[model samples]
Target: MSVRVQADPNQPQAQDQSFSAAFELQGNPDQGELRLYTPLGSTAAGIQWTPINAVLQAHGETRQFRDLAQLITLVLGTDVPVTALFAWLAGQNQEVDGWQVDLSARNQGKIAARRMAPALPAELQVVLDN
Candidate 1:
């Protein structure tokens, strides 16, 4: 799975830049592995976790974190509800704090989500390549 993120222009700290990344995710929030690939299709980063520990691999190095969220933040520079993402992609709405995912147009291969609570509300629009 992959998503392209855009920050709301109306927000103060919002940036005009957009984020695009590819993901290879499995399992649920509690136990899963997610790998983010570079635009060139190289392995940019990866996160794997279980109840005991979470690890992040990037730049030919591995770092440990207490949870997936922490590792994700460190990697993406922001927090995304990846768990809810699967549900959203399937056209089901899952509650994600500060974020509202809209899949109404999923049939058209488009899905968008907005972060409402953050000071700089951001929008994430995903278009499945498949």
Candidate 2:
């Protein structure tokens, strides 16, 4: 699925890195691949991860990560609750440890969530293509 993520810099955990990216992620959060592209549709990076090994390819170079969290945090500048994403995408309001999700518009192919407890509160919005 295609997604656009916006990280608020005001969030303490955001570490002053305000990022916005449009990317396509495929596979399951447990074991899957993600391809991040430039707005113009060129590949910026690609990541494939499994329980044992995770690899990220970018800038014509490939690097291996010890785990998915590290790989994703390195790329996105923050750790996203990927496991909860499956539930969110399915229109289920599953709460992560520090995040609150709103799925009222699931039938409309839209959902939004936010981090509430953590010092850094960031919002996530998703719109699935019909």
Candidate 3:
């Protein structure tokens, strides 16, 4: 876990900024937690955290994950690259897989379940990758 402190604008149209701290987490496929603290509100999702050899249970079963980034990409469908995903998850610098994964129907278009990649693993990864 890590504390992310930064200036956050209260509203989209507001012209003010405040210091915010987000308790971020990184884990493998099955479990992870992302709890963010801001002056505005709490942004917590994907809280089941794991790592290399991290085991996650979903759909009535337990599974193993490669690393923390892949877990989020699988859960969120970001399709992050192998090299990049590694750098982010392993903490080569200071960022983890960061992206807004909007998997709405129209945006997804004709993308089918078979098309999404290591981006989606087994029944979990490709469900959105396609």
Candidate 4:
């Protein structure tokens, strides 16, 4: 999976950034784990969350957060529609506020989405290995 975030013109500090990693996302929106791997296939980061808390482990350090959404926002510099993302991955076209998803290439194991509102704009692209 790869993610690219365009700098928000309204935010002076925001800068364009891109990330690519092999990731595994499990469970539902309320309780789940998202693990990212490096290009060499080693674990890069792991995020696990429940209704109570979210934990991020990376670079030999573990940090806790109030929730998955907060943790994701801090890391990505924007909020992602995680709940809708799960549905989209499952071949369901779910509408999410401020975001648009395209699943035409889902049969080819490809998914693309873009966020057009709410501060930062981002583009997310995923290619399933399976």
Best by TM-score: 4
Cα lDDT tens digits, model 3, 34-55, are 4444446554332354444444
> Can you write out model 1's per-residue Cα lDDT over 5-110, one digit (the tens) per residue?
4566667796654556876767777888878888899998888999778998899999999888787666655677877877887788888878888888899878
Give me candidate 2's TM-score against the actual structure: 0.78
lDDT by residue (tens digit), candidate 2, 49-115: 8988899999989999998889877776567788888789877777789888888888998878776
lDDT of each model, Cα atoms only? 0.75, 0.75, 0.36, 0.89
Evaluation by lDDT, superior candidate among 1 and 3:
1
RMSD of each: 3.5, 3.7, 16.2, 1.5
| Shift of residue 61 alpha carbon in model 3, Å | 1.0
Model 4: pairs clashing at backbone N, Cα or C within 3 Å: none
Question: Per-residue lDDT for 24-74 in model 4, tens only?
Answer: 989999999999999998999999999999999999999999998899887
Minimum summed lDDT over a 10-residue window in model 2 is located at 1-10
Colliding residue pairs in candidate 2? none
lDDT of 4: 0.89
Looking at candidate 4, what is the lDDT of residue 42? Answer: 94
The lDDT of model 2 is: 0.75
Q: Which stretches of candidate 3 lie over 4 Å from their true place?
A: 1-51, 79-130
Model 4: runs farther than 4 Å from truth? 10-14
TM-score of each: 0.76, 0.78, 0.27, 0.92
